[model samples]
Target: MRIALLTEGVHPYAQRAGGGWCRRLVEGLAEHEFQLHLLAGDGGGSGGGGGAGEGPATYGPATYELAMWGRRPAGRGPAAHRRRAYVRAYRELVRALVLPGERGSFASGLYRLAELTRQDGALPAFLASGHAQRVLEREWRAPGADTAAGQPLVRDVLVAGDLLEQCLRPLSAPWYGPGPGRLGAVDLCHVVGGGPAALPALVAKRLHGVPFVVTEHGLHLREQYRSYRSAPYRWPVRALLLSFFRLLTEETYREAAVLTPGSAYDQQWQQRCGADPARTRVVHEGTEAVGREAAGVEPEQPVLVWAGALEPGRDADLMLHAYARVRAELPGARLLVYGEESAPGYLDHCKAIAERLELGEGVRFAGLPESTAQAWAAGTVVVFTGLTQRSPRLLADAMLSGRAVISTEVGVAREVVGPSGLLVPPRDPAALAGACLALLRDEERRARFGLAGRLRAQERFAVAPVVTAFREIYLELVSHWPAFPAVDGADGGVPRPFARPAEYWVAGAMAEAH
Candidate 1:
């Protein structure tokens, strides 16, 4: 079967992000024809050095890359009549954005704009034009629009217009059409990421009869909300762009044939975003399971392992403070931090924090581990201190390695840890320290937790089960393909699945006869 895998970010194309699960999915299902659609660089944050490792050593031939900020080629510009429609569409789109009462116009306005872009092919130019800014200004100043916070200045309108154009670029992509080698020809459109990455899949399903599956490892809309809080945009720009993302994500969730959240935590977010409970599935992100032999051997010292990128959100400071308390009680206890700095100078910042806490030789920064098993084997208990960790792959790796875990009660920690380990509230050093001390003091408890954790990882998070689930999902969606509701004009209606009988009355009759 032909499958189109749409994703956002530099994963698979770059060595960053641990080779990414996309590569694994494609490799696991090598018998099927897979086409990759990647959107690079979306979060408009400024950072130095390409962050992590070099480009991927082997990017498959099926990959298609599009940069979020790539320049659009100059067009002769749309005809005069078409220009008016573009202006009206932009007006409606911005209207839906700024006014809460007009939220229902979002989907209609969005697809109308997409149709205009698909027909004329100058969406970026149109968005960057003065016309787009005027629409945004008028919408903001319109009656019922929420301008009580503050009126948007000229610069704010321009910035918001540019952002909107960048996000909507996928709608103008040439990947659609019913011809072979295009998205329409694919047996299924699988969106590997949420938000803008799903934009292409949305377009494909809208233009063609193809069904799309959305697999969300993290809640993209939630991430957008958090990121925009720290973003350098003005309030007006933030408000407008956030609304666009909010509405777009909701439309994606509502339209998806199936919503596969990487964990139960993310599944809740999907439902809150309007995903149908009957259509939603929780698929845990998988990792290679470590052998029992590797997990059975414990480190001699009472060591605590913290593995993750050394970024501000990871709250390394809290971990240091908690470890300081642990050292006071058990002077022999050690804290080993593994992984490199994701945000520049975060490593030095953590080191300075350790100094302030006066955690002498008890705390040590070990660079990236050669392998996950080695990292988990180097310590008796694994620790996580992030304020927000969506997938928490290292937590799974620790469980797979048969090591006891103590994680912040965030993201998938509760679901992943279950009864195998301990959980502490985020940013609470006293609670974290208490949990660590409890585990370190009791070797029997740690051993029992480790064994249980290993078993849980093997049963739940192993790669084979995850692949099998998708294999079945793909077939299930395609098996009922031709029943997809026909796409209505520009303002596409929500596609409904073919109805199934609530009760198998025919089979019931057969059973009654028997």
Candidate 2:
């Protein structure tokens, strides 16, 4: 069985994000064969360091660049130290973003980004290496580059555009392969990341009879909203950019033969944004269930653990506000905020909130909680404060560690926690605080809830069940009906899938014998 593992910022790239899940997915279903179709991006923001442009082909010994982001020179390091490589990658990335609807959308995008690469390099190198000076040099004075002034102004506005493009480079990549001209062959395009990644999947499914699958582990548009909204851009531009992510998300969901969101929170968003519920499934993020044997946390006081990006959507500040109330009730209580400062002003916000709530004493920002079990082990209760409910893995780990949870009413928390843990409405610090205080006061009740959550996590969130479900879905989609079989066209090119247009599966299925 041929599978096109369509992904963005994962796989071949050594990152702990969506790529990890794709690797596990492939490893799980080793029984099936896979061919990757990638839309690459830099690991940290440069243009071409990405393994995405090519990947090692799986059908015997074949070589290709996998989808990734970054360009550190084709040669080895210690010479020139990646200064020029990033400049070249950024030129290409900028070129890709600037060109629009000039016959080929993807091609137009490719050239724009490529030109940037030739100028200042890719996004990852630019950000990781701290070479914004080069961006200034090229943005205003490239030989063929367009600038408002005869000389580089270094205006704040231009800097804003530069930053916006820098952030979006990952969201915008040459699909199918390194560039628009090349698209690999695959049975289906399984988009590991949505939004920009999904756009290419739609194109692939249309150009070929490629069955498209979308797996959203982290919501792309949600991240984009956070990006454009808080970006230095003013109101109008932010709204417009967010709209782009929204539209792409809708189109991606519409094109997918199956839309598997990593959590129930994502599933709702997909439907809200126009995905067909029939085509959607909530495939919780898989875990090994190793926590049962690993660590067991026994915090002295009623400890609350919140580990994730300290950002707006996660609402760490609000959690702090609630914690102030909890401390009033339980003075010896402790809180561990795990995760790096992802958004600007977010870490400050958490600190200020902690100060105002006057619970700043024992609250520590534990970066990237060594392990889910370690994070969960620190708390008698794991709490989530976001209004956005994606799969609450924080709770899953807590449950697995035998810790009760206190989460806001958003995402799969209600479904996962049910009657086991205290649930509060999101953004309401009073309610969140009150729940924490209640849970702290009742040790026996907290232990019971923890036990229930642990049972549920072990029973449902285990990886095997998830792999089996996906295997069945794949078999059903394939054997339930035959898709395009290879056929040659008049020009000797292989005509796209089976024998008809790819739309037939969706359209023809609607009218068949019903």
Candidate 3:
């Protein structure tokens, strides 16, 4: 089956994002043909890097590449003929987004915009127009608008308008309609990331009757809330931005044929964001097993290792405080932090915290280790202090390395660690310190937990099972897709035989029984 893999800033291109998992999926499902539909972004802010627009970064020969939407083009503004309809559609879209409980309007307006774009390819200029700002301002002041209670300023309106335009820019892309490298020919539209990345798939399903699938490694809505929480904007601007994202997320969830979350935590978030429980499935991400030789190796100095990207959410300060408490008890104990700095000055901030705590040599920032296996071998116990995570790769590596873990109670850490390691509440230095001390003080328990962890990683977290699960899901979705109106004289442009529904067999069976 041919699948159109949709991603926004995450796969086949971005180095630091969830591209690794996406690359794994593509490589694992080698039997099926993949058409890459990338929603590229400007390489700025956290987790940002080179996108498809920076020229093609190789993802091997099996993938067919399509258009990438990154930087907006400089154009002569919206055409005169399309202005009226564009204004009307744009107004309704902003109204539905700003007002409370207007999903119907939101969906209609979204599709209307998609249709307009599909027909004329003139959405970008219209979205960036002065008329768009006027529509947004009018909608903000509309009666009974909950978000408008804040009485937004002109600056707020302008910023919100620009932000909305960026979010909706995918509609202006030329790849939505019929023909090769477009959404029309794919058997299934599987969106690897959510939010704007899923926009094309939504349009494809609406325009071509194609089945849509969403796999969220991270909760897009939750991440948006975190990102916009401290955004240097007024409450109304933040509200507008967040509300738009929420509406988009809900639409994506409601329309998806299936929702595959990387962890149960992510699944719960999706359900809370209006995903149907029956349609949601938990497909845990898998990793390769590191060598068992690293297990039970006693280092000269008792060391605790924390590895992964140094981000604010990782709560490195909490790690330091806990390590300080540990040092109070065991002065010789050392905490080795190994990972790349995700944000500028975050590493320095962590270092300052360490200095303030007077954990000079007791805490060390080892940066990215040359060999992951060697790094795992250097630690007596692996630690994860991140306040939020969805199937963190470092935790999986730690388990596979056969090291006992002490991770905060967030995301799927408990589920990932199970009985093999100790769990503590997040942001509690005392609790984290206690948990770390428990594993550190007991050699027998550490050895036993290490063995169990290795077994669990091999049994449950291996890459083979994840690949098999997705392969099955792909086949099932394609095989059971309902028949729809043909495009270009082809049956919904899906692979033959499976494009048609199984109603005939069911009817025949019932008739025979009667």
TM-score per candidate, in order? 0.84, 0.67, 0.86
Top-TM-score structure, candidate number:
3
| TM-score of model number 1 | 0.84
The model with the greater TM-score, 1 or 3, is 3
lDDT of 1 by residue, 1-514 (tens): 7788887764221222323588778778887787776666642221111122232445452555555654543555566888899888888888888899988888888888778888878777888887777888888888778653878898887777777877887777666665434676666888877878788888877777678999877777887887787678888787887788899999998889999998888888888888899999998888755444545577788999998888988998889999999999999999999988978999999999899888888888999989877888899899999898787577887888888999999878899889999999999999999999999999999989988988888888778888999998887777655543333322154322231222444567889999
Give me the displacement of residue 148 in model 1, in angstroms: 8.2
Candidate 3, residues 378-399, lDDT tens digits: the string is 8999888888766556677787
> How far is 114's C-alpha from truth in model 1 (Å)?
2.0
lDDT of 2 by residue, 155-225 (tens): 54344344444434433333333222223345565677676556555655544455777888767776676
Question: All models: lDDT?
Answer: 0.78, 0.61, 0.78
Measured by C-alpha RMSD in angstroms, how accurate is candidate 3? Answer: 4.7
Question: What is the total number of backbone clashes in candidate 2?
Answer: 69
Clashes of each: 0, 69, 0
| Cand. 2 TM to true fold | 0.67
Off by over 4 Å in 3: 10-16, 42-58, 61-71, 74-81, 146-150, 230-232, 289-296, 308-312, 339-360, 488-497, 501-514
lDDT score for residue 305 of model 1 = 93
